[model samples]
Target chain A: MLFLIEDAINGILMGSIYGLTALGLTVIFGVLKVINFAHGSLLMVSMYAAYWTVALTGWHPYLALVIVAPAMFVFGYYLQDIVIKPIFKAEQDVREPITVIIVTTGVWYILDNLTLLLFGPQYRTLQDNPLRGRMLEIGQMLISVPKLWGFAAAVLTASGLYLFFQKTRLGRAVRATSLDRQAASLMGINQYKVYNIAFGIGTATAGIAAVTLVPFYNVFPTVGVLFDIKGFIIVVLGGLGSIGGALLGGIIIGLIESVGPQFMTATWTEAIVYGLFLLVLFVKPSGLFGVRYDW
Target chain B: MTRRHYNKMAAAIVLILAFGLPLVVRSATYLHILVLLYFYAYLTTSWNLVGGFAGVLPLGHAAFVGIGAYTSTILYLQYGISPWIGMLVGGVLASFVGVLIGLPTFKMRGAYFALATLAFAEGIRVMVENIDRLGPFVLNGPRGLQIPPLKLGLGNLVFASKEPYYYIILLMLLAVLALTWVIARSKLGYYLNAGGEEPDAAMALGVNVARSKLTAMAMSSFLTALAGAFYAQFTLYIHPKSVISLDLSFEIAFIALIGGRGSIAGPVLGALLLRPVSDFSRIYFGDTLPGLHLVIFGVVLILVMIFQPRGLQEPLTRAYNRLLDRLAPGQTKELGT
Candidate 1:
């Protein structure tokens, strides 16, 4: 019973972080109306950023978020403005431009291989950090301190995002553009600017997720590939564009990965997750928390 | 001669050169590269049936290739079956899986379909990696399966020389290209084109767009699996990572798109252009910069998409027609001079 409880707690905590990792993907999808295939590469870039920040400064891992997030925001903003915006302009009539997907995929291959060339394939982890391997214990239970911090970060980020989207002027402009780009344009909102901001926000969240992961995860050029697929599944399961749903979906997957090993091999859980994803896709193409109407 | 005759003559010349090149290029290294080039051309052509004609990007065609490679290898290793026969069995099995996947996925739109296919392929790869044994069969898990080169000949499908593999893949590419040409003019071809461009309109016109897409998927999967068996025989190895990989799937799509999807000659042109670039880059800079080729590929993909959304085939084809017009002014003179 205690083992199960321990696993569940770990699952929830880890799951929230997974949700955080996928947050940027959902945000980008919500506004761009296209699945950002380069989203994983962005995560990878941010993780490297976080890794270097903490390693070089000898600061707390979370403190690295201050620098990484803003930097990623700028990177994503220009990426959209310069590389992707042209494709959007060409396919303005298309609700979801397939060519943009290909372009993002191109970005993915470039970013990942560029990193490989620059940093080599060797995996790096932050050693001797303040939150390296700390454990929290309460009544025969032991939990990872980094994961707890990750959980707080996920909740805070999601809530903060929710509020920003709901209350702020820029947030409303983004929402309006997402609802109807042409109509928003007619209302004098620069839809292109909104797109840049949304992409920036999304990439910034990936940076935040990277900071949380740096304390616990290994940093590598291809590390994002691992989470990239997971982010896709989580976003789909939680419902694409649903902030809370991403969190819930991540918890579900986290639970499966954590508790599933009790009865089967660790790898089988991967199959189960895939199976569940397909089931959701067939049964509810809109996703668990997504609206029935197409975005 | 008429323009049609000129076109046929051109095709014949290309074919003859393709067949006779192996005679002149006796070096084993170049032969190996040529064989792999033909192999990619064959794989990309097969991928074009669904991805190009059906207008949906199925990024997981590697799943079918993996299925074919594994089926043939396992049958040959355990059951003592000839790989030639195993190849057919693999093709059939892949077709079934393809249809099964296409059923639910064909209902989805662009991004959803792409994601679903990617997940399905990843799931299959994960399953293959985990299962070392399934009842009587041994998958060897991540260790993969290796075929011993004991038997040799056309019948066995294991060759001692690279020329045999080159000729075989070349023949397969020609056959698939012919098949694509035929399909492009057929009723099924028209239906597929319609469905791809405008599914709702196609359905309204009684095109049975879903069924046509599924049919194309089945055919594409079968052809792709044949290449997988060919790959297993040529390399004498079968592994989850190499045979069933996202990179292979993406490469196929990249070739199709860059060469111009939905066109018969696009895959061949793409393979011709991309294979040499990737191969030579890897050979020259592999040690110094391991992933430089992929970076190049990404840059090329971006550049081509940005400049020529229709692919290189369009410009090349137009140039070819202009050349033909200049050469064969006699027909125009007879008609109007």
Candidate 2:
């Protein structure tokens, strides 16, 4: 019973991080209707940004988040405008999801290779501070302080986002555009501006997730690929465009990963998750929280 | 009738060139390159069936290849079975696994399908690395499985020189090419094309959308597995990292994309072009400028997607047709005027 409880706690913590990572992907998909395959690479880039800031300026890793997150936001806005917008604006039926996928995949390929070229594939750990070594003891089980902080940060960020989306005018405009771009445009919402804002916010979330995760996870070029897959799976499981679904899906997958290894080998954990994904997909083609669209 | 006659003549020329070229280029190195080209072309052609024709975009083909390689090598090492029989067993097992994966995930389109395939490949790689016990011949995990070159015989299919492997792979390539060509021209091909172009329209038109996609998946998996068997035999080694890595899957997909998808000749063209470039890069730049070739290749990929998404074959075909028009002016006029 104690073991199960510990697993559950770990799963929730892991799930919170997964949720945070997936928030940006889901948001982008919601507004732009494009799956950013490069989202993982962006996370990787942000993690490095945070890593370098801490190394050079002697700033606290958390403090570096303020800079890295906003920087990523601006970068993402421009990236979408330059690379993605042109593709979408092309004369052909270029807005097909497959075309978006190919474009993002190309971005992923370029960025991943760039990271390898720059960083040289060596795994770098954030410098050990008091926060790094500390752990919280509960009964016989120990929980790392970094993971605890990650969970708290995720909850706080998500709550802030929820409040902003509900209250702010820009958020409402973003939501309107997501629902119906043409209708939103008719109602005086600048679709391009909304896209820029949404892309910025989405990438910012990824940057924040990177900063939060860096304390525990080692930074590497390929590190994002694993997290990216997990994030995408969470987004799908939760239902596309459903933030709440993402949260729930992340927790479920986290628990599965945490407890699955106990029953079988850890190697089979991924297979188990994929197997479950297939099962869910077969049963609910629209995803756990996804609404069916005419398309 | 004239076109049919011309096609038959072209087919005859190709067959003669395929079988008889080995006699002229008896150099072991050239033959080795030919074998490699044939193997990759065959593999990529198989990949194009599902990824190109059906538009499923399986990013985990290397997993199927790994399955085929592991099955044959393990059987050969343990049960003392010849690879001739072992390869068949491997191909069947891989196809079965492919069916299992395809049945559930084929329901989803685009990114979801791609993600699922990637996850499957990673899962297999992890499993292969962690299997601790399998008797005296423990798969050396990350280091990979190494086997001795078997005696050359009809039953073994193992060769002392690259000459025999060249012919074997050539035949395999021709067979795969012929098979893909048939599929491309058949009703099933039409169904696949329709499903890929517009799934809802195809479904409305009485196409069994799911069945068509699954057929492509099964065929692709089978051919990939066969190629994997050949790869294992040729290299005399099979490692999880080498066979099941994401890099291998990416390479296969890259070849298909770079050559052109949805065309019978695309994979063959892609494999022939890119393999030599890669080999050349390895020889010249590997020591002094490691990873440079891959960096350039990545840049090329980006440029290709941005500029010519249809791949190198489209422009080449147009140019070739223009040249033909110029060379045979009277012939073109006879057909049109």
Candidate 3:
């Protein structure tokens, strides 16, 4: 019973972080209406950025977010502006351009392999960091301190994003474009600029997720591929564009991964997750938290 | 001479050249490369049935390939069944699975369908990697299954030389291309083209879009599996990472896109162009730069999508027609009308 409780707690904490990782994907999908296959690569890139920032500066892992977030934002903004915008312009008539998906996949390949070329595929963990291997003990229960921090960070980031989207002028512009790009454009909103900003915000959140992960996880070039697929499943489960749905959906998956090994092999947990995803897709293609009408 | 006569003559000449090249270029290394080239062309052409005609990106075709390779390999290793028979079993099984998956996923839009298939494939791979045995069969998990080059004959499908493999793949490629040509002029082809462009319109016209898409998926999966079985026999190895990889799936899609999806000659053109680039790049920089080829693939995919979304086939086809016209002085139809 105690072990079950321990696993559940671990699941919740880790699941929230997974939700945080997927939050950017949902946000980008909400606005851009493209899957952004490179989203995982972005997370991988940000993890590397965070890893280096702490490695070089000897600061707390979370502190690297200060540099990584802004840099990632800029990277994403320009990536949309330069590489993806041309395709979007050409296929302006398509509600969701299939070409953009291919382009993003191309980006995924480039970013991952380029990192392999530059970093040589070695797994790096933050050394001499304040959060390294810290654990919280509470009488027959041990919880990872980094994961607890990650949980808090996830909640804070989620709330911040919600408020940003609901209250700010830029946020409203983004919402307007997402709702109806043509109408938003007629009302004088720069649709392309909104896409760039939404992409930036999404990348920034991935950077934040990277900071949380760098403390507890090993950083590597292909690390994003693992999370990328997980993020897709999570976003789909939570409702593609729903913020809270992403969190809850992530928790469900996290719970499966965390608690499933008690009954089956660790690999079986992955199958269970996939099976559940397929079930949801068949039974409720709109996702658990998604609106009935297609986005 | 009429354009039909010229086209027939040109096809015969190309066929003659293809069959005779192995005799001229006797190097084993080049023959091996050419065999692989034909293998990819065959795979890409099979992929085009659904990816091109049906216009849905099924990113998990490698799963079918994996299925074909594993089924045949297991049957051969354990039951002493010929891989030739095993290939058919795998193809039938793959088609059934394909139809089952397509039933639910075919209704999904582009991104969702792609993701679902990807998850499905990944799920299968993980399962294969985890389970070392199922019932009486030995999967060996991540260790993979290797076929010993024990028997060398037509019946065993194992050969000592590359020429046999080369001719087999080349014939397979030609046969698949011919099938594609036939399908392009068939009722199913028109239905797929119509459904791809406008699903609602096609449905309104009573086109049975869902059934047509499912049919394409079934055929595509079956053909893809045949290639997979061929791969297992040719390489004498079958592994999850090598056979059931997302990269293989993506490469198949890339060939279709680069050569031109929905067109008969597109996959061949794409395979012809891309296989050489990937193969040569791997040869030169594989050890030193490990992933340089993939980077080049990514760059090429991006450049092609951005500049020539329809693929190289469109321009190449036009250029071919122009050349034909120049040769026969107005015998050919107008180019790109």
**Where does model 3 exceed 4 Å of error?**
A293-295, B332-337
Candidate 1: where is the Cα deviation over 4 Å? B330-337
RMSD of each: 2.1, 3.4, 1.4
**CA lDDT, every model vs. true structure:** 0.91, 0.80, 0.90
The CAPRI-style docking tier of model 3 reads medium
> How many clashes in each structure?
0, 0, 0
Q: Write the per-residue lDDT of candidate 3 for residues A1-295, one digit (tens) a residue.
A: 8988899999999999999999999999999888989999999999999999998988878889899999999999999999999998998878888888889999999999999999998889887678888989978988989999999989999999999999999999999999999999999999999999999999999999999999989998899999999999999999888888888888998899999999988888998998999888877888998845363
Tens digit per residue, CA lDDT, model 1, B1-337: 7787878898799989999999999999899999999988998899999988999888899999999999999999999898889999999999999999889889878888889889999999999999999889999999899999998988779988998899888989989988988898899999999998888899999999989999999999999999999999999988999999888888888888888888888888999999999899889998899889889889988888888887889899889877877988756533210
Ranking by TM-score: 3, 1, 2
Model number with the top DockQ: 3
Writing each residue's lDDT as its tens digit, candidate 2 over A1-295 gives 7887888888888888888888889888888777788888889888999889887888887898989999999988997887766666552343345655666766777777677767777899887744676678988987778878888877887787777777999889988987888789899998877888888888999899999888778998888888788887888788876777777788888888888877887767776777677666567756787756322
The DockQ-based CAPRI class assigned to model 2 is acceptable
The collision pairs in model 1 are none
Q: Write the per-residue lDDT of candidate 3 for residues B250-335, one digit (tens) a residue.
A: 99988888888888888888988989888888999888897888898899889999888988888887787777777778553732
> lDDT per residue, candidate 2, B75-155, as tens digits?
777777888788888888888888888887777777667777777887788777877555765676777777776566767
* TM-score computed on alpha carbons, candidate 1: 0.98
